[model samples]
Target: MRVAIVHDELMRKGGAEQVVLTMLKAFPNADLFTLAYNPEGTYPEYKNYKINTSKLQFLSRSVKWMQRLYFPLGVWAMKSLKVHGYDVVLISNTHSAKYVDIDNDALVFIYTYTPFRLAWEPTSYSQYVESRGVYRWVFDKVINYLREIDRKEAQKGDFYLGMTKETAQRIRDAYQVEDVTIIAPDVKTVNFKLSDKEKEYYLVVSRLEYYKKTDLAIEAFNELGLPLIVVGSGTKADELKRLAKPNIQFRSGLTSEELADLYANCKALIFPQYEDYGITPLEAIASGRPVIAYERGGVLETMIPYRGDASKATAVFFKEQTIESLKGAIELFQSLNFDPEFIKAHAEKFDEYVFIDKIKQFVTDKYRKSRQKSSPKPKLASEKRINS
Candidate 1:
């Protein structure tokens, strides 16, 4: 059967993009569809795919602005796509793929990271505060309209797959849709290895963003006088660097191999945000380094409880995202003992092979059920002779 996999954009290789790649590998014959593809010196693995980008390629540089102005354009664009030939369509979305149009007979599966959180009351407050002027006013109205459309389109899909339980709960709350399945993001294990090197300092690996709470990690490290190494870059990089103390070092644009090295030797990984489903924490655990994460959101599901026993605990939890909470967790980490073997074993649960197998099973089962329902019944011999 022909399959088409759609994604928001192939601009960056984040957790969402990794999910798309895994899907493609599982369905090697499937064609990939996206709004834009900015090579941007990404992983060479992407170079081998059959990619079909939208007509918006000319406006690729300003796609972000365009999304704000023409919020429903993605849905409209999909109406023109020749997906009639495909039997199944899988959408790996963090944004607008829920708006895509597909044949009624086709099986459409959506992998939702979150259900348009920016349209909700308390969440939209944060979005509005981060915007300015007429653009802000215009976007607020546009997002509300899109939220309604998103809910309608969600109902058309045969299945909804969430990357985390937090996201699945949001889907239920926002769209009032049930029967959602949770499939956590997977980590690449080929390049990463368990090292015997002595741990030196703590590490934080994430895009520098306001919502990520990188500042909280900086503040905690500063107050505790601990050496902290930060990897990854984003809009808040310069601002975060300005506030960082001498002991906190900010390095951006490192390859996955380089990050694995840092994860292998770091004393512990510091995750300050309440993420949807963070991959960095899992990577650190795979490298045999324990995680010190805020005790909320997906972290609660991923991290093992730290009870001052090195042989038993794989991670420690901080109940708050504030500097004091992180500082307290760091102090506790210093006093506790952690086993590297136990940490690595916990990470193996989300390894690439397991993730790939799950996707294959989900898609195959969905397609089989769809075919059975659409199959025609056998005609009686007398009815068949009438045509003759």
Candidate 2:
């Protein structure tokens, strides 16, 4: 079957993009569609596919700013695209990809990382804080308008695939939609390898965003006087660096191999954010390293408590997201002896093979059902005459 895959944007290589790549692999002949495509030295595999971008590409250098403004516009543009011939359309969305227009008869599968949390939790640290100005007012108005549009689009989709159980619950609450499936994110096992060589420093492998809580890790590491190596960069990088202590080291933009090495070698991976479904912690665990994470959201679902003998957990969790809380957890982990084999075992559950199998099954089942409903069967002449 011909397939069309839609994504929020192809501006950067992140967890969402990884999911899209997995979908592409599942349907090799599928054409990719996105709002923007700023390759900016991304995976060579992306170049092999037919990626169709929206008119937002006209922004050129101002692409980032345009994303904030043209989000709804991108959705509207999808209606103009000639995807009617495609048997299935799969959307890998963190944002507006859910808003794509498709045939009512087409098999539409929506993979949601989060149900637009920025719209629901506007005051959350992850959201863009705007100052009192014309731009701020306009931004708020636009965001509110787009949020309603997003909700409408979400309700129209054939099925919703959530990255985690927590995300499924959130989507149900936010959109009042019931047909949702929980599909955990996949990790590329080949990218991460187990290492015997240990490092004293803990690793924080995430975008240096406010919502990521990189600041929390920095503060905790500084207070504990522990060596902390941060790998990745984002909007908050410069400000976070200013707050960094002598013990904290920041490295921006590393290849997947380099990141996997860091994950394998570090004493433990520190994930301070309450993420939807963090791939980094899983990667660290797959590399036979335990994680130190906030005890909420997807982490609660994935990580087992480090305390109970009956409990089988791959990581230690902090009750609070504060620096003090994280520091205490780090110290506790340092004092305890964690089983690396157990950690690796837990991570194995989210291996690429499992994810691919589950997704393939879901798509195949849906496609079969769609065909069964649409296919015309041979009719009896008597029945036909009666109908006439």
Candidate 3:
């Protein structure tokens, strides 16, 4: 079968980007499509693939600038992409790449990270943008326009594959469509080969962005007066650091082994963000560290919370995305004793083997169904007689 892979863009090697990489590896012969590609910004391994990017890639100079143009020009550019030759198109995306024009007979399965957050959950997206001074009346009108188009495209999808059940429900609500299969992303469990030594400090692995609520984590840790180490860097780093107390530490550019060691040593993984499907928490769990996460999004599917049986729970949940909730969860985490064996085993459940197997099966099934759809169904003799 002629297969193709479509991603919204490649700017960073995040969990969503990792999914695209996996899909590309799954169909090595398939052509890779994107609105943009930045060799410097994302994984270097992506250069090995046969990539086809839109004209708009030139217009979207930087990763940050692409955010503003993605809705306006990226949507238009992707919508006009002529994906006529491919028999099966597996789109690993969160944004407007879903609206690409493909052969009517082709199986267009959207392995979605999310329905565009700006379209579906406008509040989180807007609050950040408005804070940056772009959320004027003109911007609201443009957003409304984008949301309308996005909703229309959502219904046009042949099938939807979500990373979590929570995302599936969100898609269902946003698109008013059903048949969203929950296929979670896998982590490279082997990379998290860590020692059994537990450390005093807790860990935070994130992009350091506003939506992530890293600032809130810093505030919580400050109030608790505990050692908190935040890994990774972004635009919000300076601001987050300002909010942080002496107990908080920021470290960037760690090697894979070093990251694993960090994960292994920390008391627990702190994930303040509500993500489509977070891989960092699972990686920490694979490293035999329990998670202290904001109890929403994909974490809900992965982390089994600590009840009376601490050995059974892979992680602890904070109810609200507030400093008080996080502080309370951290205090609770200090009291509990987690089994490393249980935590490691829990992470193994969504390993690369399982994820690849499921993707292969899903794509094969969808391809067969698509072919069947293209073939004509026969009418009964009575119906033929009536026609005559």
Candidate 4:
């Protein structure tokens, strides 16, 4: 069977992009499709595949520019994609890629990170765009238009997959769809190993973005006067750096090995954001490190929260995303004793192999069911004759 994998765009190295790469591994012969591909911005491994892009690829190759154009032009670009000669089309979509046109007979499976957040969740989207007065008026118009389009596009999928229960609920609410299968994103557990080095500083492995709540970590670390190593870069990088005290240091563009080293030796990973399905916490846990995360979103499902059980806990939960809540969690973390082996073992549950197996099986079963429905059934021999 000819399989095709469609992603919104291959523009950056994030959790969604990583999932697309994993899908490619599962279907090695599958053709990869996207709206755009920026080689310098995305993972280098994608170069190994013959990535097919829409007309948008010719307009601009800038990752930042492409991201800015996502809402306005993404729907059109996604809809422009005409995927033919495929038995199954697996869409790894966080945005408009689910709109891709496929053969009517082809089984379309959408692995949604969440329904288009820009259209459905205005508060979260406001962080990325200027939303006040005239801008807000225009934003509202654009969002309303996109919401209709997003919902309509969502109906194209034969099956739906969500990374977490929270995201599944979001998908169901946004598209008014049912039965969203929960498939948690994976981490490369074997790639990370616990180091023998001293745990000297706290770690924050997230994009420096407003929605990510990286600022909360900076504020908390600044007040605590503890050493924090922020390992990411984004539009908020300069602003986050300025907000941070000398105790908080910023680093970016590190290799996997370099990141794993930091994860291994860090006091604990500080996750301030409410992610759809966070991968960093799992990565930190795989390095035999405990996480101090905001008690919300996918982390609640992934990390075993500390509720007076240090032996079973893999993380200390902060009730709020505020600085004080994070600081309190940090203090609680310092007093607690975590078993490194236990933490590592917990992370292994979300290993990449497991994710691959689940995805492959799901696709196989769905494809078989689709084929069975389409195939002609034998005619009944003893049917009642209608009066002429």
Candidate 5:
């Protein structure tokens, strides 16, 4: 069977891109398609694959600026894919890969990271547009147009998968699709090691973006005067650095080995974002470290919150996004003792191997059923006798 894997874009490294990488491992022989590709911008493992890109690749050369055109051009790019001959077309989508044109017989499964955030979650991204008057006006117009296109494209998929219940709900709200299945993304737990000796510094492993709320960690850590290691780079990198105190140190461009070392030795991870389904917190837990996270979004589903027992708790939850709330959580975390082996065990449940097994089984079952439906049935013995 010919299998095709389509991703929205391969311009940067994040949870969405990680899902695509995991899919490639699951379907090693499948042909890979994308709207664009940037070797230096994304994970290096992609360079090993034979990647097919859409016409938008010319404009997607610039990893930073090209994303502004992704929603519109990404839709056009997906529509341009030659997925007709494939038996199964699996899309790792967040922005616009769901629009891929394919034959009616081809099974299309969309593993949605979320509905296009800019089109559906305007309030979360208001900071990006609110400052520029003319830009904001144009953005609102484009978003309105994209919403209709997104909803229409959503109907083309044979099945939909979401990373968490929160994202599943968002998919239903944005696309009016009822049967969204939850398939949580996973971490390569084997890459991380459980450590009993931890350094004094707290950790924050997130893209430094406005919506990610990395600034909350900076402010909270500044007041606490604790050593903090911020492990990511983004558009807000400079501004976040400016906001941070001397105790906060920033690092980026880390290899998997280097990152795992950081995760293992940190006192705990400070996660402030209301994420779709966070990988960093799981990565931290896999390293036998606890997490202090916001009490909303996917973290609620992943992190075992600290009530009175630390033995079963993997994290301490802050109710609000404010710095004070996170600071309070940190203080509360200091009083609790989490079991490293227990935390590590909890993270192992969402290992990459689990995702691979579930996805492969789902595809096999679906493909088998699809073939059963389409294949012509043999005549019964009585019918053959009658014809003779």
Candidate 6:
């Protein structure tokens, strides 16, 4: 059957993009549909695919207006996507892709990283609009308007694949749709390896953003006077670097091998972000490094605790997104003894092969059921007698 795939954006390479890459492997012939596409901005591997973009993509090729008005415009552009001939339209996104239009018989299977991250989290949305201008209220209205559209679009899906149990509940809360299946994203076990010798520094692999609470990590490390490496680039990169102490190092444009080396040698990962399904902490744990993270979102689903009532936890949690809490968690992490082999073993559950297998089975099962329902047939008495 002809299949189509939609993703939130191809603007950059991140966890979501990696998930799309996996999807492409699962459905090799599927055409990629998106509101925008930038071969340079996204993963170079995506250039191998036949990516069909909306008109908005061509219009914003030079100016990149999508970065500013992505929600409203992206939602509008995606609604124009025609997914009629395909038997299944598998969509992946933190928010936008679900709005893509589908024909009556086309089955929509959504692999949501989160149910519109900015809409569900007030602080994040506020940070987004606050960064824009004095007309925060006007922006708020616009977001709310987009949210209503997003909510309706969500129900159009035949099924929802939540990255975690917490995210499944969050999906229900966001869209009031209970037909969700749990499917975890995976890590490249071969890419990350434990180091023979570890350094006396912390690490954070997050896109620099206010909502990520990266500022807290920087502030805490500044006081600790320990080497902390922040590996990522974003709009907040300059501001975060400016606030960081001399001990804090910023590394961007590092290759996967280089990143794995950094991961192998770091004391532990300091994860301050509240993500839907964070892949970085798992990657660190896979590299045999413990993680000290805020206790919220997808981390709660993936990370294990070393303290009371814990069961093979690969990481520890800070109660709040504050310097004091993180500093205390760091102190707590130092006092514990985490087995590197144990951490790596726990991380194996999220290997890329496992995730791909699950996706194949899920989509295949869904496709079979949809086809069966559409062509409703009963077993003949002769067939039943022969079976009996």
**lDDT string, candidate 4, 120-222, tens digits:** 8778853536667887888888889989877777777778999988899999999878889988888889889988788999999987777899989999988
Residue 207 lDDT in candidate 4: 78
> RMSDs, each prediction?
5.9, 5.7, 5.2, 5.6, 6.3, 6.4
Q: Decide which is better by lDDT, 5 or 6.
A: 5
For candidate 4, the lDDT comes to 0.86
Ranking by lDDT: 4, 5, 6, 3, 1, 2
Worst 10 contiguous positions by lDDT, candidate 2: 379-388
Point to the candidate with the largest TM-score.
4
* Model 1 regions lying over 4 Å from their true place: 62-82, 121-127, 130-139, 374-388
lDDT (Cα, tens digit) per residue for candidate 5, span 268-355? 9999988888999999999999999999888988889999999999999999999889889999898888899999999999999999
Clashes of each: 1, 0, 0, 0, 0, 2
lDDT by residue for model 2 over 223-260, one digit each (tens)?
88889999887778899999999899998667777877
What lDDT does the true structure give each of the candidates? 0.77, 0.77, 0.81, 0.86, 0.85, 0.81
lDDT of 1 by residue, 264-292 (tens): 99999999888888888888888988889
Clashing pairs in 2: none
lDDT of 3 by residue, 297-378 (tens): 8888888988889999988998998888988999898999999988899999988878888998889887886566655554
lDDT value, residue 214 of candidate 5 = 88
In candidate 4, where is summed lDDT lowest over 10 consecutive residues?
379-388
